[model samples]
Target: MQIRRVLAATSAAVIAATGLVACSSDSSDSASGDSESSEQDGPIRVGTTDAAKKAWAVLEEQAEAAGLDIEIENFADYSTPNQALEQGQLDTNNFQHLKFLAEYNVGNDSDLTPIVATEIIPLALFWKDHDSLDGIEGESIAIPNDPSNQGRAINVLVQADLITLKEEGLVTPTPADIDTEASKVQITPVDAAQTPSAYGEGTPAIINNSFLDRAGIDPNLAVFQDDPNSPEAEPYINAFVVRAEDADNETIKKLAELWHSPEVQAAVDEDAKGTSVQVERTQEELQEILDRLEEAERNS
Candidate 1:
């Protein structure tokens, strides 16, 4: 989860009540909803968020080259694909990270698992025309209004040398937890979904990649990215998620294999302009990462 989902984490329950549709438990023959019936079995079902269209296009090409057909469904909200998968409405999804998956599974009791990680997308510090972070007056910083995202924003500020943390590895940072008064930067705490709009007010904003891209900001041009390759990225690197039971399914294995191929990495490298790095972690590894995140959250 990035700042947007993090910001929505607390309010997620309320929103989940009214925002999400009922869960579905309809799984198909293949792990990702690709029927084993025949090659002519229409199309292989694939579900993902609206934000992931670019990456999936490359994946789609890979699938076609691998002799598999693909049908891509764009989900508006973040919660539907899993439910659709449970209902057998979809074959596979690729929009979430490990933290989101763990939280979702714990809350919903869904057995969704991730076979491999895809990209390390950083929740970055974005600004409209402020040349550099040095130009950002710490007196005012607009952060995501959501609790989880607020923490992420706080952490980003800390990373930019704009502030520091009371604890080294706290997960959810609150206003009261600013470590030092000298760096006591004021935060606007705008809603995560609205953060991209916060930039024009002469205030730097921290937001997720979707919002950043939606605002037409080149994510690569951001003043600072959260450093997904850093050791600190241990708790928050993003991944392509699926049901836990599908962890070893052949379709998932094939997809994961393709996702990890040199071709995919090359596509990412070439297409993203170095804004993304490939990630590949096993289900156990993801669980371990989630466990670490839970511990961080607990002590935050």
Candidate 2:
């Protein structure tokens, strides 16, 4: 991906206006639902946060060649796609990780499930005010405010030795969980969408890869990056999401197959440039994580 791709990632105002709707929970089979029957006539609608049309162009061509109809709709942020999927506006979505979807379900009382695993885009701490971690001492640092990724930002800071978290095994630590006395820098929380803009405010902000990519920042320059293969990163693997009812839908299963195909994986790797690591997990493991996250979210 190039500068233009970054521009596309951030260019959601035009699409958001038209694509985002008040996501309802009523998924009926009246052409709007994920009914296997509804997939017989037209292209299956898929949702993503960024415009992945180019990223999946090769896959799209291949799907077309195989007589499979699919269309990807890009949204502005994380919240809308699951809502749209639950409400039957989209056949499936591939924008979020299982933990994110689980959190969404817990928050909304919806049960959108992940049927296929995609890739893990590791979270990294990028700084504009400092060239090295040592220079970040005593500075006010910004991190993502969303519950799902907030703990991740904190974990990166912990890995960087900037702060210490009070809890032993917090899956989603908030600012309240920070051990201020032991911390070297002041921690501030802001919306995940605002993390990119949090920089240059006399503070180094910890930005996620999705937003960092949108800002066109070089991933290699990140002062610290989380290991995507670590146990902590298991919840962050992206996936194809669908309503619980469509878990067995043949078209959706086929779409997942196409997405995980070697050709498509190669295209994703070529375009992602080291930003995303392709991954696949057993369905049982994915479900177990989902169940655990659901329990955690409910408890939280």
Stretches off by above 4 angstroms in model 1 are: 1-44, 294-300
Q: Mind giving the per-residue lDDT tens digits that candidate 1 earns over 132-235?
A: 77656545777877554577678888887787777676666787777667574667777777777777665677878767656677777688867787766755
Which candidate comes out best when scored by TM-score?
A: 2
Report lDDT (CA) for all predictions: 0.64, 0.74
Worst 10 residues of 1 by lDDT: 1-10
> Per-residue CA lDDT of candidate 2, range 58-115, in tens?
7676677667766666667666677667766677888888788888888888878788
Q: Score candidate 1 by lDDT.
A: 0.64
Model 2 lDDT-worst window of ten = 1-10
Score residue 236 of candidate 1 by CA lDDT.
61
lDDT of 2 at 63: 77
